[model samples]
Target chain A: MKVLVPVKRVIDYNVKVRVKADGSGVDLANVKMSMNPFDEIAVEEAIRLKEKGVADEVVAVSIGVKQSQETLRTALAMGADRAILVIAADDVHQDIEPLAVAKILKAVIDEEAPGLVIAGKQAIDNDMNATGQMLSALLGWSQATFASEVNVDGDSAVVTREVDGGLQTIKVKMPAIITADLRLNEPRYASLPNIMKAKKKPLDEKTAADYGVDVSPRLSVVKTTEPAERAAGIKVGSVDELVAKLKAEVL
Target chain B: MAVLLLAEVMGDDLSVDSTAKALTAAAQLGDVTVLVAGGNAAAAAAEAAKLTGASAVIAVSDASLANGLAEPLAALVVSMAGDFEHIVAPSTATGKNVMPRVAALLDVMVISDVMTIVDGDTFERPIYAGNAIQTVKSADAKKVMTIRTAGFDAAGEGGSAAVSDGAAADNPGLSEWVEDKVEESDRPDLTSAKIVVSGGRGVGSEENFAIIEKLADKLGAAVGASRAAVDSGYAPNDWQVGQTGKVVAPELYIAVGISGAIQHLAGMKDSKIIVAINKDEEAPIFQVADYGLVADLFDAVPELEGKLG
Candidate 1:
């Protein structure tokens, strides 16, 4: 079965994000960009499925301006067979919401018709858990989100969802959408040989308009402002005073 | 413009805080409707109706929904979507699971964990965990969202409304409900607790976490831990609080032995009053702490307990 894994390029998780001084958005000029933390898990899971012979081919896809190609390359390095860069990866000005991205992805779904699709539960930057479900809806496919474990049988796959209290397992047919949770698996580091191999691997680039998707911003940004800054607090001298103060304040 | 608030019920009872918080968020839109999904949700639906400004309560009672499974609940919301323009829910795991499915089915945009409802079409959500705040506007005809429970006040009780029954949703893709391995502790729920006492690698060993538990039990607080502690096997994964873990905003957050890494801060910095107790005064957690006590937690914790005694 072919597996399609969607990856995203976002500000590195370790880097301290600074809002633009002009208050337009985040300052991404010189900031280091990396594959989204959760997307790494998605790619890693897809690669493991191929390694274990659960999937025949693993294709990685990314929707962003030109810089996103680098992330797709990272996915290839990790173990994806090839990559698809939707829209110029380098277009710094191109910003599309999850719904629009899903629209573009639906076109890829129609073209490739992969049996399984894996995505991160949510993106760290937008934190919107929409694309995967939207893709499932657009394609009318069964979806198992926040998947911690997955075992594929002949034509059906059993998935374990990470819920609030514990875990819930569900069985779904092929041609399904499965999202990766944090505990799904530990992502492996790409070796030097794999990185070199990824460079030679195929990367197909396409425009959002090619799929009849309008990458227009529907939501208006009337104004951007920071949250209220927390006030300065008191410093306690001793445990006794701390206990008394905490009791007086919180208890 | 009517807003639909999906209320998650715990057993036969309505999650009062979650219901109230969702209602408060729905109030930002024009009219409000609370849809309670569970078994015997009559009491919960009635209570939901008593909330000061709620417009109506629609109870979808089913033995299957009692577990709060995502697919069936999503189907229920989808079946009832035609009446409302905006759909809202608490940013709990269940809400997070169901909202995206509903939004996807409706071919609309979903804004998760919104801290402030700016207008009918716009909202403010925390980005990079809770460090940077991003305000987004959904241009879709139907808007779906998850409200941060800590961001809004509960809708006041005593308003009058009738509770109506809803049709059972047909979900062909739902997962089965098995046994839940809940951490049975007398402590309160971490996200909703007013006081939270968390530990980190500085707690040293798994046994050392007993100090945090003792403190939490004494104060009726929830016990939380840093990823380091959870990774070190000092605590359970559910207790982990960081950018990748649970996001919490207790009234009083006490960090013991935690150095306050940016990831860890992203989870609890929204806390109202923070107290940091660590040997290293330069710990990043002290930067955000309302009260900083420079001392070895090994000694400070026991002393504080004695003082409480």
Candidate 2:
């Protein structure tokens, strides 16, 4: 079965995000961006399925500006067979909500018709964790989220989901949506040859309007300001003294 | 304005903590309706009825929801979404998974990990691993969301309401629950545990974690580990407490052999009492620690465990 993996470009996890001085939103004019960490897990999981021969073909898709082509190339280096870029993600008024992205993804999925869809649990930037479920709902497909492990058995796959207390294993059929959890597998760095080959692989570009989706955001950002900084407090010498100080100040 | 809480049921019983928290959040929008999903969830329905602010309890027991897994749960929520303006669940893993799907199905934007419900459409959530808080406002007609459990107090226990089968919807396509292989631990759950004793690479090896465990057992605490420990394969991912991992707000948090990386502190700094034990007195963890003890974890943990025991 063909596997489809979705990726997004976001601020590198190590880089601290700064709010725009204008209070419009985060200052993203020149911030460093990379493939979202969770999407790395998605790419890794899809690659693993192909490596294990569970998936016949793997296609990577990204919904964003032309810069997202870099993200799709990164997915290619991770071993996807081809890539699709919804280039109109650069539209001046596109909503930041995952559902708007999902609307475009629904169009892409209809064309590719992959049996399995894999994506990161959530992008670190928004931390919304909504897209995969949104895509599943739009396609009327089943979703197994926060998956730690996935084992395919013919038409059915056994997925181990990471939960609050522990793990829950679930069986899902083909044509399912699954979001990768952190424990799924460590993603591999693209080999030099694969990186070079990624340039040669096919990259298709489409517009959000092609899918009849309004890219305008529903929720407007009235203001985005930095959270207040916490004050550094005194460190007590001993446990007894610490308790006494805390009791006086807080209790 | 009316609110509906999709109460997460543990087995056939009510997760008192989740129900109470969901009710507390639902009170922000309007009248509260607690939804219980599972077979023979009568006990859970009864417990939900006691939620102080909840107007009613809508118990929807079905074999499809027996496992409390997301796929079927989302479908159930979708079938009932038209009745409420606000739908919320505890920001646990299950809620995180299902709530977003509900939003997606309803074609509305969702606000997640909300710490405080300021109004029907506005809320505050922490970003940058709780270092920076973001206050967001949702314009969606139907608000689908999850509340951070630690951010709000649980609803008081005492309201009378009737319980009955709400609605049984069709299970979504493609997913079904099989079995769960839970890592059974004697200590309390890391998120809910009042006391958490965490270890780091300084703890040395996978075997060295037992010292932290012994201390946790003595104090009836949960055992946590730094991201470095989990990345080094010294512990399971579940043991990780950091920005990318679980955010815990406990009553007492003790860090042993931890260097106190910024991301690590972001996860547990909200604890009421913080203690640090590291050979390096200058570890960043000490910056947030109310109590700092400069001693080797190997030497200090056992002594502390002995005293607590």
Candidate 3:
């Protein structure tokens, strides 16, 4: 069985994002970039499945700008057997919409015929948690999202999902889509030897045109702005003073 | 443009505040018809009928929908997609789970976690985990969205919209519903609570979380936790209060031992009055806090809990 993990390149989780001065989008010039944190979890899970003998191959794919090859290399270093990079855009500033990304992924899946696709629940950049579910709809496959625990049985997978008030466990048939949540697993760092080996790994590059999919943006960004700032209030020295201040403020 | 609002129903009860907030967003576009679908949604449809501005309530009851397997629910929404120009749902776990699949099947882009309806075709939503706001115009004829309930006010009562039976959705049978392990609590729900008390990794361990809970019980506030706390096993997953966990904007929010990472700030920064009690004076949580107190949570939480009584 093969496990396909779809990763994304986004602003590093540690970096503070800044809106462009022109109100166009986030400023990306000289910004530190890395694979999305959630996608890393997905890659880790896929590699772990291979280690457990449940999967024969782990293929990591990223659909983004040309610069996303670095993210693919990182996934390869982390134990992915091979990688596919769909250069949907040349300009690094352009953000590909999730629907188009899902379509491109669907095209890739058709060719690969992987038994499972493990994807991040949402990208930290756009915060659009849609791709995995959208792919499931396009493929007419079962989906268990925000998965915390996953155990693959004979022809089905039992997954525990982190939900609103509690955890929900569900069983989806094979060839399902599973989206990783925060607590799925702690991802491991790529060793130096693996990093060197990843340089030799095959990374097949393709274009959105190659897949015959229109990677056009359906949503036009009218503007981008920083969130309203919150003012820091005076600090109280004692517990009694804190309570008193809170009382006066709320009342 | 007609709007279909999907309301999640558990047993026989619908979350009025959550549903009403989504209705307020739907009312911005056009007439809204509420779709109450879940375990015992037939009875929940009656409650949906009371939310103001709803044109009608459609109830879809089925045991398969009990766990909100996205495939079947998305199918139901797709079947009804022909009647409305816009299909919207509250940004709950179920809403986020199901809406995009509906959008894909309908061949449209889904706008998730929309904070504002700029116009019929445009919306303002948080990106970069609420650090940056982006205004987007959807080009699709049929718009599919999940409303951020924290952005809009709850629609008032005094409505008696007609309730009607809707055909149950065909189970795709791609997924099987397993038992849910719900953390049964008598306290007000974390999202709807007027006051929220959250702890972080600084609180130390699961045993130490009692002080946070005691403070919450004293003030009748809901208990929440930063991702650090939830990840450390100090708190449960549902108690997480962050960009990925739950977006809450209560009247008053108290951060106990929470250092306020950017993700944690995104979830509660919309809250009206913020109070932070942390030993680290330079903690980012204090920067957004309306009242910042530098103190040990172990000492402050118990004292504050005692004073509230």
Candidate 4:
């Protein structure tokens, strides 16, 4: 069975993002960009499924501007069989919401008919955590989210989810959706040889218009502002001083 | 707009603390009707009826819903979607797993982990690991949201809401519960704890984490760990406190040897009073700390424990 993994391009995890001076949105100019950390785990999981002989092919897809092709290429180098880029205009890509992204993925699913769909639980950028669930609903398929462990059998997959109280395992039929969580697995880096080979891999590019998906924003961002900063306080000279200060001020 | 608040319950007992916080969030929108979906939910429904600001409690009991599977719970919420203009629940794992599906089936966008209700249509939420706050206005006719319980106080008791039976929808049977392994603990929950003592990579080894435990026990605080410590196997995955893990806002948070990466800060920077102890005086954790002590955790932790005693 073929597996489809949706990746996203966002600000690098380590980079501290700055809100635009105009309060319109985050400033992304000249900053480092990379595939979302969670999506990298999704790609890693799909590749492992293929290595385990449970999947025939792993396809990585991304929705954004032309730069997104770079993210798809990284996935290809990692282990995806091929890549698909659903290119959008700069403005459209900048403001594309999870619902729109889900719609675009739905169109791709209809065309590819992959047996399973794996995606990141949430993008670190918007942190919406909605796309995978929304896509499953649109496709009328079952979903297991925040999966820490996934085992695929004949026509069903048992997924162990990381929940609030504890771990909860659920079994879903094939042709379902699964979202990757942090503890799923440690992602492997692409070797130099694999990176060179990825250059020759077939990369099919399409536009949102090709799939007839309305890449429109439903939510309007009124403003973006920095969070309240906590001022650094005085340092205590020693344990006795610290204990005394705590007693007088806090305790 | 009438709001439907999903009650978080464990077995037959209601997680009244979290449900009350969710109710507080829902009350901001308009009248709230609580939905208790689980097996043997009568007791939980009775508790939900006592939550202030709710007009009524709807009880949905079934074997399929006993485990709070996403498919069945989402279906139940969708079936009742037409009765209210907004659907809200605490941003717990259950809410995060189920509410998005409900919103999608209803063909609307879900505003998740809402920190503030700017108006009926607009909300404030943290993005970029709480480094930035974004104000968003939704255009959907029906709004679906999960409230970050840390942002609101719990609604008081002494309410007299009515309890009624809710019709059970057919279980999609798309998923089944196998089993669960819960880490039973006698300590206060990390999220609700007034004080939290967290260790980091500098703790050296798993065995050394005992210092952290002893400190927490002395202060009746919850034990937390930075991702680095959890990755090193010094702590359990549940003890991880960061953007990818649990978001906590305790009255006092003590960091031992934690360097305070942005992801780690995202989780605990909301803490009321932060105290950092690290040999490295330049550690980023010191920037957000209300008090800083430059000392090795191995020495300082033991000294602090003795002093507290």
List the DockQ of the predictions in order: 0.49, 0.52, 0.70, 0.70
Winner by DockQ between candidate 4 and candidate 1: 4
- Residue runs of model 1 more than 4 Å from their true location after superposition: A88-94, B39-43, B62-67, B173-179, B204-210, B229-236
lDDT of 2 by residue, B161-229 (tens): 777677778775467778876668788888888889899989889998899988888788899999899
Docking class of 4: medium
Candidate 3's residue-wise lDDT over A128-214, tens digit each? 899999999999999999999999997999999987777899999989999999789878899999999999999999999999999
**Candidate 2 clashing pairs?**
A94-A215
Chain B TM-scores per candidate, in order, are: 0.93, 0.94, 0.88, 0.94
Better of 1 and 4 by lDDT: 4
Off by over 4 Å in 4: A91-93, A247-251, B185-192, B230-238
Docking class of 2: medium
Which number leads on lDDT? Answer: 3
A250: Cα error in model 3, Å: 4.2
How well is each residue in B25-129 modelled by candidate 3, as lDDT tens digits?
Answer: 999999999998887786789888988899999998887777678998999999999989999999988899999999999999999999999899999999988
**Residue-wise lDDT of candidate 1 within A39-139, one digit each (tens)?**
99999999999999999899999998877999999999999999999873345634577778888888998999899999998887767777887777777
Error of 1 at B244 (Å): 1.3
Interface RMSD of each: 2.2, 2.6, 1.8, 1.5
Local accuracy of candidate 4 as per-residue lDDT tens digits, A134-168: 99989988899999999999899999998875688
lDDT, candidates in the order shown? 0.83, 0.81, 0.91, 0.90
